[model samples]
Target: MTKIADLRSQTVDQLSDELLKLKKEQFNLRFQAATGQMEKTHRVSEVRKDIARISTLLREKRAAS
Candidate 1:
């Protein structure tokens, strides 16, 4: 899990890249859950929250500019 403070220090481009990666992982987790192959079910929510955190930070950065 990524801390909000750590995310806040990253550049927008870096945050975007991290968001994309998290989204991809989210997709895979959903697929695995559907197929009954998911091991760490809690990870789904963790990734989702991380994506939200990054998005919120990005918006804050844009608004501050």
Candidate 2:
């Protein structure tokens, strides 16, 4: 899990990369849940929150530019 402060220190490109990675993980988590193979269910929510955080930060950067 990534902290907002840690995310804030990253560049836009890095954030985008992280977002993409999280999205991929999110997709996998969904698949696992559907198959009843998910071990840590909390990961789904954590990934969702991280995705939101990264997107929010990206938007803030865009708006500030």
What would the per-residue lDDT of candidate 2 be over residues 30-65, giving only the tens digit for each residue? 999999999999999999999999999999998898
How far in Å is the alpha carbon of 29 misplaced in model 1?
Answer: 0.2
Residue 6 in candidate 2 has what lDDT?
A: 97
lDDT agreement of model 2 with the native: 0.97
TM-score of every candidate: 0.96, 0.96
Off by over 4 Å in 2: none
RMSD to true structure for each model, in Å: 0.6, 0.6
* Model 1 ranges off by over 4 Å: none
RMSD after Cα superposition, model 2: 0.6
Model 2 lDDT, residue 31, Cα: 99
lDDT of 1 at 60: 93
